[model samples]
Target: MTGVSFHEFRITDSQRLDFHYEIDSETEKKTGEIHFQSNIPIPFDPDSVALALSTMCGSAYRRVRMDLRVSPRARKVVESFLRCELSAPARGGVTPERRRRGNVLSFSGGFDSLAALRLMPDDTNLVSMDFGGRFSTEKPFFDKFRPTVISTNIVGTDFQRNSWSFMGIGAILTAPIHAAKYMTFGSILEAGVDNLRRLPLTSRGQTFPPFAGAGYRNAPYVAGITEIGTAMILVTYCPEVVNDSLASLALPGEEKLYRKYVLASIAAERAGLTVDLKEPPPPATRRPFGRNFTADFLSLYIRRFGGAQVRDAFLTDVPAEIDALSERLALTFYERINTTIMQKFPVELAGGLYERAAVAGLVPYTEDDWREYMIVRDALAPYHPTVAR
Candidate 1:
């Protein structure tokens, strides 16, 4: 891989942010531009610009030397990842600036996002990225408010979506970091259940959350911990922006009945929004993951292998963590998660962190673990499987 040179970036008159760059080779010379379009002009933030470019570049290049400004942390993270993961080197020269304002909600006008929108202050900057190129002005999700909607047809590229995990990360990175105080992603507690329930039936072990990055609350974007590694990198490098998820904040319990009924009751009573099955589509996506599971494989792997730094990087202080409902719900979730894995996967293939790590010599465990594992694996299954679609 050759070094990627980023030429001057400019917001075109057509509201497109363009990065002009070239790759020189013995066989031929290659030139290209990475474009992000917004109906509104995107204010330039060097750190944001660098972060977006690096994210789009992925781990393919040997060296990424860009002229744009970057935060020290952003520069450090990119250099660290390239060196450690890709064995590549990265260098940049740039200064930081306070170029953004107010919380920018990745509003999709769905149950989770709408619920989130209701919770935010009226003045919060609501932004919807048309990553899928499905942006329609007539869509119901946009009818409620006039927001700064940024739409793009970039998802069809290998650099963007070839790897399933990178999709969400790409969508998040497209955000106008220059104008955001905090960046909020729309994820729900059901997302956690979906991931845990859909734990891969293979030897891959616990995986990162399939839909959202390891369904953690207010998790800072650390390179290896979260599922969508880029988001963690963005938030980590740009301290000016906070990574938040209202769904993670509001729906801590993993109970389906409670989340669907009880939590709805709570949100409706508290937020004054309608909570029911027959509702309009959310501004983001109406139908989220129906059958896929999100896992915290990286975090669990670190807990076993990377020691305290990695563990602490992914951990957070969950406010009140759980309640009576959540406590019972959690117990039920644990018992059911094990049983579900067993039923859907071979018993030999169903174990999570403990069993998988023990077999691989990554962690130490004994026969005592089997009894506890069986309790969840063989116990009478509790929660009934719901129709995710």
Candidate 2:
């Protein structure tokens, strides 16, 4: 189908909402359901529900046309969905009001989320989306934080695999329910920086607009740090939850290696010895790199272990000059959190988190260092496969 149209949403039960949509101009329609954990029938704004549906199935088609009721504010937010042409009719006086303060985290019970939990305000509400029984094992870990769990099998088909927007859809939908001022994620540096290409240095460009338009800030508490850095935080703060909660489900083999290397590096650092990698590094591949976290992992590995042999093993595919540049960039990327990126977070919270991170041994780069990193990043951009074209 060339397009998809959202028709309406029906409350199947007190905790469930069944939605209907049509593909292109087809007479037949498709149905999906979302289940909440609340006892009372929660009042969900039509605009948020429509946006959630679009994020789940919109990517399969070229256009997403929403016929549901939406406010002017929602209409403006839909403009930021650059992947597809999404249209929503505006309904006057339908604006959803949210006056409550504080934050809600889309917690996944993973190392990254736990790290984000450490940095966020102690009162931040925790919310988790359960994909059927896939993540049931982590329920005990999640229960410790007293999180609200929402179960749904909305993106069950292969066609919906490219619906990356669904990552934050839960936080978006629940933000209004909780009246949260911000919707935060556990995203790390590797998830944000396109290190295999030119460094964008920012992760929120696409996702932030919709959340902001919906009156909630998309704040990633762990975006400034690397996975290894988050592991460090988890090890330092929540050692008991580390072994049971951390799992690299469906991650690339190289990423798995990188994660293992992180743990090894941390152990070596604590033991005051250089440790050898138990497994060999994965051979290098082309652009649209699957190993986005490799550079950050390598940087931390070198900082903790400083073994030339191990460092060269990971950079074997790169040219000598580019290898040097990558090491420098990677080190800086792991060490620094660009203060500008923290603007979306509350001033006191951001400052406190930064200070705590520094006290915990994570270095913060200065303005001069940031300028130098940008200059170096521009020079390294030429080496990217896309830029070379």
What is the Cα-based TM-score of model 1? 0.44
For 1-389, candidate 1 gives per-residue lDDT tens digits of 56557776777774677677676545766676666776566564454455555555666566666776555556665555445232223335544344544455566543345434443445666666555443332234443456665555546543463233343332334344424444444453324434334345452223223211212112111101112222222222221211122232222232221222222332233334333322211222111222222212222222333333333332333112211222222121221122232232223222332342222122221244334333322221232143121
Q: lDDT, candidate 2, residue 191? A: 64
> Tens digits of per-residue lDDT for model 2 on 278-382?
443443533222233345334333533555455544443444554465555434444456554554556546775876666445656676657755654454444
Minimal lDDT window, size 10, model 1: 216-225
TM-score of each candidate?
0.44, 0.73
Q: What are the RMSD figures for all models against the true structure? A: 16.3, 5.4
lDDT of each: 0.38, 0.58
For model 1, the stretches where C-alpha displacement exceeds 4 angstroms are 1-10, 20-33, 58-61, 65-73, 81-101, 132-140, 162-180, 190-291, 294-389
Q: How many clashes (backbone atoms < 3 Å, residues ≥3 apart in a chain or on different chains) does model 2 have?
A: 0
RMSD of 2: 5.4
Candidate 2: segments with Cα more than 4 A from true spot? 25-41, 57-67, 79-96, 132-140, 158-163, 195-207, 248-254, 257-333, 343-345, 366-389
